[model samples]
Target: MSFRLTELAEADLECIAAYTAKQWGEAQALTYTGQLTHAFRKLGGTPSMPGSRKRDDLAEGCRILAVEKHLIVYRHHAGLTEILRILHQRMDLLLQRLF
Candidate 1:
């Protein structure tokens, strides 16, 4: 059950990197990115691993996984897991039109 990042997810990662780099430093940004990537890989290996919660409003198989202060939104389909977005926990996902 391999996973892939969607275009929006990739853009979210880039935005997170940029924001972390500006607020903290390049090192912090790189470290955080690595952490997120690790989470992605883990999910790829175990697509059914319990997420923070189910998001039926988003999609049939949509779920959210929490890594630190961020939420990894993904959906499982046809043996592939598609990452939908990575958002800060404080962000209003509904208001952001993530669902």
Candidate 2:
């Protein structure tokens, strides 16, 4: 399966990049974002991969995986994995409109 990000997820990534660059450095930002990109590819290739969990409380078929301090929220449908959001682990997911 392939993968795509929603508008919110894209924005989330942009924010993450900007914040990491400002707080750490361009290199660190790139490294962190690259890891996220790698995770995305792995998830696209294997949505059922271990470490990702079904979040039924959030929405049907919703799954989440943690990378560093962020969570990758995604779902599989229509033969593709749709990334709904990239949020900080500290964020209250229940308050977010994830699905």
| lDDT for predicted candidate 1 compared with the true structure | 0.86
lDDT of 2 at 86: 97
Query: Over the stretch 1-99, how does candidate 1's per-residue lDDT look in tens digits?
Result: 489998889999999999999999999999999999999888887876766578877767788999988999988787787899999999987766453
Q: Score each candidate by Cα lDDT.
A: 0.86, 0.94
For candidate 2, list the clashing residue pairs, or say none.
Answer: none
lDDT of 2 by residue, 60-95 (tens): 999999999999999988889999999999999989
* TM-scores, all models, native as reference: 0.89, 0.96
Q: Compare the candidates by lDDT and give the number of the best one.
A: 2
Model 2 ranges off by over 4 Å: none
